[model samples]
Target: MAESSGGPKKLLWVMIILVLLSSAGAAAAIYMVLDERDDDNPEAPSEEVVESKPPVFLTIEPFTVNLADDRHGTRLLYAGITLRVEDEATRELLETHMPQVRSRLLTVLSGQEAGQLTSSEGKQQLAAAINERLSEPFDENQPPPELREVLFTEFIVQ
Candidate 1:
């Protein structure tokens, strides 16, 4: 009876030792796999930081013009325009020759038909026309001012 009890105790101790060794081995394998993954994928190079410049805007006073009587009778357009210029120098150039700028704008605006002013395409066309006209040099000797875009703040047709 004593021998039988001692044999059972020895078997239990061996089983416990086997379980502990297996658990340690599994933990070591998992750690090695994670470490290998970290080594395989080195940290990505940091992205380059770019310096961006702010846009410069020049606002023109609102314009009221008589639309062409092509399809309607004596229609009018009241539009507020803001000009995006490439630099301060172009804005200064426009400020210096405001009378000529207004004249050119009025000529283009007065020619637009009431029917044409109602659609988005017409508005885009109008902006393009304004851009083209404004891009022309104010003086024969000077180069044209760099006009980036023409934005309409308000548009009303009656």
Candidate 2:
């Protein structure tokens, strides 16, 4: 009789544990379903609006550089550069480093041959070279800015 009673007590404890576990599992399933439903609803709080930065341009003063002259006589190239920059910060940085920038540009412009500076194709090539020069790392701490274009506002070869 005592053994039979102990068996009934053990069976009752196991049944209670199983019932508790089943209840917890059901509750978890319901919570997951509710979470998925919340995601499906369009009335949920949305993501924040990201502000966009506008395009900025920086213009450098005209460069009057003497080309590599030959028997054709002394030649000059007057080029005014306008940089289409990625941001205002870059333009500000360029403004701060104007002297160094000017020196680099002058070197580039003066290196061209008179014949090379005379044609439209030559001017385009010069612009591309300027673009590359403008984007070079000027400061050791900060990275170079993205340069969209190097436009020759004034191009005269004489």
Candidate 3:
């Protein structure tokens, strides 16, 4: 009876020690993993401390010009223009040269008659010419201006 009781006591002590050892090992493993991760990014940025910038909003003024005389006579044409610039500096450059852009547009449009201005081919030609003229003022190394499309807001012949 004594031997049987001793055997059970020994087994119970062994199980307790094993349980404690396993728990300690698991804790050590978790600590090691966390420490390694912290070393990889020692100075992680805090969410609240990080700053974010707002998106920029850009817009261009619309253009209006008179077309050259045709069978229908002189015509007034209005166009809404939008330009995609690389950055604020490029935008400033464009604003500074707006008068030149306007004059070039007027010259190009004035050469066309009412019939030519109304046709699809003529509008495409005008768009291409405007893009070309705009690129002339910017630095040669800089990317060309992005002209998405040209729209005729008003067209009237008198």
**TM of each candidate vs. truth:** 0.69, 0.64, 0.49
lDDT of 3 at 65: 67
Model 1 over residues 1-158: C-alpha lDDT tens digits? 34566887899999999999999999999999998997787585547888887898989999999998875589999999999999999999999999999999999999999988899999999999999999999888999999999999999999
122-158: candidate 3 lDDT, tens digit per residue: 7778767766776664555766555444445444433
Clashes counted in candidate 1 amount to 0
Q: In model 2, what lDDT does residue 149 have? A: 89
Q: Sorted by lDDT, highest first, which candidate order results?
A: 1, 2, 3
Higher lDDT: candidate 1 or 3? 1
31-64, model 2: which lDDT tens digit per residue? 9999999999999988988888676889899989
Could you tell which candidate, 1 or 3, scores higher by TM-score?
1
Candidate 3 regions exceeding 4 Å error are 1-58, 138-158
lDDT assessment of candidate 1:
0.93
**lDDT score, candidate 3:** 0.67
